[model samples]
Target: MNNDTVIVTGSKLTIDEVAQVAINGAKVGIAPEAQQKLTESREFVYELVNSNVPVYGFNTGVGANKDRKVEADYYNQFNVNMVRSHCVAVGPEASQAEVRAMIVIRLNTLLLGYTGMSPAIAYMYRDLLNHNITPVVPERGSIGEADIACLSHIALTMIGEGDAYYHGEKMPAKEALAKAGLEPIMLGPKDGLALVSSNALAAGQGALVLYELKKLIQLADMVYSFSLEAFKGNVSPLNEEINRVRRFRGQNESAAHVRKLLQDSYLWIPHIANALQDPLCFRCACHIHGAVRDSLHYLEELMDIQMNSSDDNPCVLINQNAIMSCGNFEVVNWTVAFEMLGIALSHLSRAACFRTIKLSSEHFTGLPRFLTPDPEHIIAFGTIQKPFTALDAEIRHLANPVSMDFYAVAGDIEDHCSNTPYVVQKTRKIVDNLYYILGIEAIHAAQACDLRQEKEFKLGIAGRVVHQKIREVIPFLAEDRNLTVDIANAYQLLKSGVLLHALNS
Candidate 1:
């Protein structure tokens, strides 16, 4: 097999890559000779189910249901029934993108050959992706037990027994399969257990979250650059050598990014002689922001391994001709990383919020209150009229850390769930918050530039691009109409990668 092609073997696909394949028309196929392993595993499972060689999931019950053994004749029906009863997830259905990711994850897990499913199951998933018949899974439920409810919803549609999206239309799974010229597949032995019993959903969701976080980190750096310029804080602390001394890679990279963003700035360089060493919010930005930056990078690696791994329990061993206990399903790795990132993300948020506050205060920044061009409009700034100060406050609130507080539930079976849902949700909320805060910072920076006589304030390569984009959406805020529009415009720029494009270029 050529390594250049991205083979979705279930454990090795990234969320972005998978999305790209779906949206960009990448070819999907089983790995060469993987079918032989699939055949060997299925034969073993079948022999066990028929010859009374009892297995944990092949003929016995599951999790609290393990003690009750099923007769060999009913094992296949038992597996199929297990999926139907577990499709209890409720809420708005997950979008097609998320559902496709779910299919990718499920197929990847099955491809490990431990689930005892026939090759047809993997092919059916491939068929769904090939034809774009995504299941409509719910977003809620599942305490990370491989997202039981969500996976069940996926399984139901796969068997032509549930709901799905067909050619952008919601239809019964059977009807959708018929429309797509496909047929429902039957569960073989432990196939149902293989499908619904792991952390694929969490891993997929976490992987997507990490990808967004990477982009959000870039956005955060760009916004901070705007804040630094607006406050006209000293840039000495961002000197590469200062970060080099700390010997932290992320700190060095973040400081370098900031420097690249602000290097040629007339605002940054022209006033350095008069400015009395920068404020902590501006000068110590790397120390604070860099920690978050490094945390996110570290998290990306951990999540990458998780997303590209098989965490299912009781994996089959074709060579050993037996099943073995493996704790791959345990999610401590992600729990710890997400918890740390949550703390870092929240602090970065508070830092941005406080910096915004300092930019508007006459006590800290001699610039007119809120950095407006006219000091006579101080009251207008106080009321946050015609500007986005009030909106920034709402965005800042999203940074509060809800994941730090833990709770026990699920008869203590899930007493220590990752609470990662809160982590990812809050991280997403803060990303939105950071967008607006950065917008406000840009508005303030632009006003500061104009107040200094619109002297074509110089900026570094990346900063110039970000500054130009901000300028496009918001002209100098000369008179101020509605802050909300400015906030929305800034968010669009942030989301659309104008700032990021500048940094990369």
Candidate 2:
């Protein structure tokens, strides 16, 4: 575990902080003021419970049973039943880091004072993170109209009725709690609903995806720069003055970064490029990558709101002295943003695939076909195109939006959904696939660079570092025995962030 701690203020939780607590094992603490709000909201909930006022998911029932009234005497049993009934999520389970992300995110929002859950439950969330006790949460079973199906498993662990990972060992939730010197929380009114009726399953996974994408985009720029050097491609398209005219932030950022990566390279030696204009994949890479950046920025902004705001139904209003039914749990806005990101990434996948294809073609690079050092004896990158293109095809298919494809549940009372979890999951798959696609592109680019025996054919700063890094794990296609191993190594190299780190260093 890291020695650092993230203090959740209910209003200022950043995605980076989420990653720290989630992926880096940073401990979490609640701000004093936020804890005060949690206490105040719970008091107000008790006040309503005494007054016999009918509140959705409070005095009354939830969903199709909203009209059903619950006696104050039955609050504990009702809440427990609600939690037990909702544990319907199925495998494959989320990673321990992802479950940690979900817990921290939900814990942060509960501090906003809208969820009238017990303060003890809030502290349980903190304890789980600190003790490294992660609830075994399934990654599926929600149409994203709040992720209740998946999140209920988290509540189940808290109540000591489900499975959990105690310090990385699989065990019963009750046993995990005892091993950590903690006890199971008793469910109270609104506690179950507050715990399960959250988009944390989607949001937590999405945050990790976004963190990876930030690195992936940088990796994309680095690889593209190296490929540009191998192709001896024109650098005019990356000229800042030309890109600045369009005023697109993403395009301009990509163009500027590529220029920086290619600094002090022979590609800039006037008229050194092979052709007047390369294919759109090479010429407009910045534009496509820029579109992804733009989409990512949009999603990040929306995610900020999501991570900080209350997504509770029957949100408690301390100022107004009332509890109101709300659709705050609806995440269509950000869900669609994730959808747009997937589409943008599809473009990125295709561009990388095309660039890899071009690198193997003699018509584009003036090198041996398939980047073979010996045309007769070696078949370097010829059949390798099939796997990368197949991955790209899968990306294209995964990019199709599923947000609008849902049927109403709860007697049609819940008629709409964003399918946010699935959308984020699909985006994760796309990012993973891009690594292989870009990795193959790197392999081809490095081989092409080695084949160019001319002294004038030189590597830029980024190309030199990337070429050296790629060759460390994968050598030149000397005799072309087995390329699958090389492709896997390239994937690991790119996914590991070593090349990006080297370039920056």
Candidate 3:
């Protein structure tokens, strides 16, 4: 496998790779080590099924039927029946990218061989991804106890029993598989349960959200720097000595970023400071944004572990040759982390919204009201505040945690649950709100840059890149024009990674 391929060998699949395949359509391959492990694990499972060892989901039934023994003659039927019975999701289908992500994540986890599945099953997943045979997984019907109904839809497609989107059309899975030059798989003993009874759906969606959020945070830092510069804010708060005593790693890093972003601005003119003290949003820039950065780092580590962990039930320990029941599918940890993420993102978005509002006010940035070029006869960017109000509301609404809202299900056996997928989906919704809010701020900051027209008070390298980039898509609010198009274009620049690249470079 090469860099273009995400090779799964239990320990090598990173969250980054998962996102690559989910979002960028990167290829996937099972490593030789994983193949060998899968073979040995399958041998143990076969032996357990032959002997009277009572392995769950293999020789025995699953959940509420754990004590019931599965006859050897009905192994295939048991697997297929379990999947067919569990496919109860109802609602609009998930996006193709999301379904593809679940396939990739589930494949990576299964390759670890601790789930006691065959290498061919893992290969089936790889083939689906590479062939773009995304199963039509419904969006609802999951209460966060591992993506059961959702993943089962994909399992149905594997057995050639459900609908799928093949090369951009909804068709029968058997026809789609044939079109993709592939064949349907035959489910063995616990194969269906192994495919669907894990947190892959939530984990996959979370992986994609994390990928987008990483860039959003980077862009947020750059926009914060630009807004502070537009305000001619006092740079003293971001000085090296301020963080030297506190010694928070994230804070120190953020303060350093601030310093670098303002190194070329007039605010750094020795004894020249703007207002002695600026607003908390401006003065405590590092503390506010750095806390979010720290939380993001924590989520990254947690996701790294999750992407590689065996998160299925009845985990098979190949070395011990034993299949044991476990509750690894409980994904509350992931939901809690995402909830924290939503809260932190809401704050950052609030910072962006408030900073933009302050920039529009005459007392804050001292520029013309609404950043209008001629405040006499024009209401330039005044109405610009309206959209941000709604954006802020959505961001705040998404920030509320969903982890504490779940209770027992499945006959009280699964008493706890993580609204994992919804949490991640809401986090992505917050990101969607961030695009507009941050874009609006970028527009205002650029307008303020034009109003000040500081020749000698040049913007720092980071701010300069962003200011120049905004100018390319949206000119200064010279006279009032419908800014809807401008806002969209500015957001496109942010979504395209142009600003982040410029700022970091």
Candidate 4:
């Protein structure tokens, strides 16, 4: 876990590898090929700037500043000024993982030979990662306008002008570099521009979001399984023949996962039931949940593309006849995908919440009211009520659609946006919310199974595993004085992935 050993060679750096670079113990470095690419791109930019060519960021200005020409002598100052001027982000500092990802991802874009950064500048970033010296990047600011405010903080740290985290402590950039036995280098003509003009912050957020969403989907399925058995719900909706008629790939895959999980559950069989069919949506589970699975798959593909792309502007095309200053900066693709993901995530919360409510309702499962095992224990409410009381409201709030909101700024220069940061942030929050919600469901489900077991009835192997997992954290609720503690304990199981492994098993 040392910072010096987690370098990405570009040969087999998977998604986990990228995420690990963000963690405190992670170390990252550039491969030899990437270093060579950085050297060539830097040389190419230097050649053009020395020849007095009109590049967008080198000799010329940026955005509205595109028309302003800079004196050759002031180029170095301009580069340094770019870092100092744009370090304007304000909000909570990003976690070390996010900052490290920003560094690695920005380095990946530069390795594409388009950013025109000096090899020394690239090596400086590599050294920062290798030595665990990461810039303290803020979590907010920047409407994707060149990521200037965001990356500037990182760039400032590189040249000993900003603050950074070293040895789990925040300190002045100079002091951190000194502690790491390093010296900050000057920014080359294109170094500041190269460092700032990237969507790495957003991209890194998207990458981490993808990682968590993948795990969330698995957890959702497990919770849904536990919830299903808790209600002794009908299972006709999972008929392979019915799913085959739809011919949807994700639907089929979801059906398989559900069927495998429920295969050992004897209580799910229709033995002279009063109703021939159950609610096809939540009861069938696979059909509705499968849609989410399909959507996540699509989002994962888009996220992978986004994470591995160069979403900067005025890409340096040394080989091409022209510099392509395109809309790679727009981020509409990420916006749409993330919003779509938000919708899917909301649906999941809705489904899980409905199941939780159903398990607690006397009209549905014929179980004790609120699945409390004993209703007399329904204590008073207040600032410190039961955990499920707070859990109920939190899950409902998770359904809010952040992607649908809008704000116009800078005289409408950035009129509309997907609010991707909000979307990702909410998604993370909802996942946390669902963890608790499912934990409550786990307790209720296990209680229902215990009730059945006392009657000389039993769930199959799958149900038994789920029941035992829940019991490990929350014992059979003989009398629920404080449901809060049990609810929290159940959530810990979900967060720890112990509940997930049990359900999947």
Best by lDDT: 2
What TM-score do all the candidates reach, one by one?
0.89, 0.99, 0.95, 0.89
What does candidate 3's lDDT look like per residue over 1-505, in tens digits?
1247777777767767887787777888788888888888888888888887888888788888888998988888999999999999887787888888888878878878888876678888999888878899987778788889778998889989899988668999999999988878887877878977988878888888888887887788788888888888888888788788888877887888777776677778865545878888788768877877887888888888788888988889877767898889887776788888789878787878888888988887778888887878889888889998898998899899877887777767777777787888888889988988899998988888878855666788888999999998888777878889998998899999998777666
Residue-level lDDT of model 1, residues 13-123, one tens digit each, is: 676775554444454677755666677778887776788776777778776676678886786699889999888887767667666666666666677677677778888
Backbone clash pairs for candidate 2 read: none
TM-score of 1: 0.89
Give candidate 2 misplaced runs (Cα > 4 Å): none
Per-residue accuracy of model 4 over 303-382 as CA lDDT, tens digit each:
66666666666787778844567667666666667666666666666666666666666677676666655567642122
lDDT of each: 0.70, 0.93, 0.83, 0.69
Name the runs in model 3 displaced over 4 angstroms.
1-3, 503-505
Instruction: Output the number of the TM-score-best candidate.
Output: 2
lDDT of 2 by residue, 1-505 (tens): 9899999989999999999999999999899999999999999999988898888888788999999999888888898899889989989999999999999999999999999889999999999999999999999999998899999999999889889999899999999999999988887788888888999999999999999999999999999999999988999999989999999999999999999999899999999999999999999999999999999999999999999999999899989989999999999999999999999999999999999999999998899898888898887778998999999999999999999999989898889998889999999999999999999999999988988977788899999999999999998788977888998999999999899889888
lDDT order of candidates, best first? 2, 3, 1, 4
Clashing residue pairs, backbone N/CA/C < 3 A, model 4? 3-27, 6-27, 7-29, 22-97, 387-484
**lDDT at residue 419 of model 4 (Cα atoms):** 53
Candidate 3: residue 504 Cα off by (Å): 5.1
